[model samples]
Target: MNGFLQEKPIKNFLQSMDEFFSNPFPNSAFPLTVKETTTANLIIAELPGINREQIQINVYDHHLTISVNYQELITEENTQQNFFRSSQTYKRNSRTVALPYPIDEKKVKASYQNGLLTVTVPKQKGKKIMIEES
Candidate 1:
């Protein structure tokens, strides 16, 4: 069956091409390794120079997003300067990951340690999903 009268999304072929050209150099996302546990999916992100206190995690609209914000101090020692130059820089990065299925938001657990952020999203106790013939 042809989708002649059905409403389409806002994205089209031209829009996709425009978006790709607009963002030439994409930002490097957090290096993450996702694994399935007994009850949940575990995602570990390797983010250096991120403070534990600055890590933010939230669950919204059945989606989970984690943002990390921190500052790194860089001191120039050999720069031909009479005084040392120290600069503090701030960077913020976020990642949005969807669960395999609907999950209990209250059971989400996240922790950060040694520049690594670990997240545990538990699987929901769900009813048997069945498809019926129309």
Candidate 2:
């Protein structure tokens, strides 16, 4: 009975860890806010510890996408034993949002400051069509 109890707790712990790692954005590492105005749409994202070159923004039709790619490195060195160890890790994440109105690709603008990414997409002008009945 004791062995059974011990095994059950260990199994549950492992399962919980597996679920956590499998879920994307488990800790809300990437959060985004969108605001729409009469003339344009604005997107604000919080990306701490990331550089401007590591982020990519795309606007197509009514969709907006934000992608990030970065690398992390860890190094350990010991002079007495002459031992050195290094490890590199690469991480990539992306999020996409659908806007209510079509965007003007030529006028899209983005800026990053103080770990905040702001994107502005202007609304496309609509053309009116006239129908004539004969």
Candidate 3:
């Protein structure tokens, strides 16, 4: 009982903190970090255990949403008792980000690789500029 059982609370607290910082969108959504540049806006989110084909990306008006569905097949195998237990469930998660300005839908692009989803929404020319004459 002295090996590692005393650190359960500490481990749980650290995990909670990690989840808080890992996601930038609403608490219910997947997690995304947005970086703004002079040329374009980059949105990055990690969707582990999700395949590229099961992901959906959409850009509408000034909002960007990415969704991924994961099918979990949990199997418990007992070799000693020669028995097996299987459970299947599907989890769906989607994250939406609001942009500072609207963009041309046709100019948007997205790429998914290595369990990482990258959504790039290029800033439309003069999209964020407001003209004021003195």
Candidate 4:
């Protein structure tokens, strides 16, 4: 009975840890905000601890995508004992949003400053179709 009781607690603890790590970002790593104007749409993303060089933005048709890729390398050495250790970590995050109207790809603009990324997408003009009487 005692053995079974101890095993149950261990199993429960392991299961809880698994659940926690499975969904590391329960909400999201970064918060995102989108605004729409009369002629353009604005997208703002908060990316802390990320560099401008690590961010990528793409605009296609009515879809906008933001991707972030970061890499870190750590090295430790002990000259006296001739020991060395090195480690590298890589993380990637991405988000895609759909615009209400077709975007003018040529007029899209993006900027990154102080860990904040902003993208401006202009709306494409609609073509008027002529109707003919049969």
Ranking of candidates on TM-score, top first: 4, 2, 3, 1
User: How does model 1 fare in lDDT?
Assistant: 0.77
- What TM-score, over all chains together, does every model reach? 0.58, 0.69, 0.61, 0.71
Best by lDDT: 2
For candidate 2, the TM-score is 0.69
Query: Which stretches in model 4 have alpha-carbon errors above 4 Å?
Result: 1-29
Per-residue alpha-carbon lDDT of model 1 for 98-129, expressed as tens digits?
87576577888888888888989987776898
TM-score of 3: 0.61
Clashing pairs in 4: none
User: When superposed on Cα atoms, how far off is each prediction in RMSD?
Assistant: 14.6, 5.0, 6.7, 5.1
Worst 10 residues of 1 by lDDT: 1-10
TM-score of 4: 0.71
Candidate that beats the other on lDDT, 1 or 3, i.e. the better one: 3
Candidate closer to the true structure by lDDT (higher is better), 3 or 4: 4
Residue pairs that clash (backbone atoms under 3 angstroms), model 3: none
The TM-score obtained by model 1 is 0.58
Model-by-model lDDT, in order? 0.77, 0.86, 0.81, 0.84
- What residue runs in model 3 are displaced by over 4 Å at the alpha carbon? 1-28, 72-88, 127-134
Off by over 4 Å in 2: 1-29, 100-102, 131-134
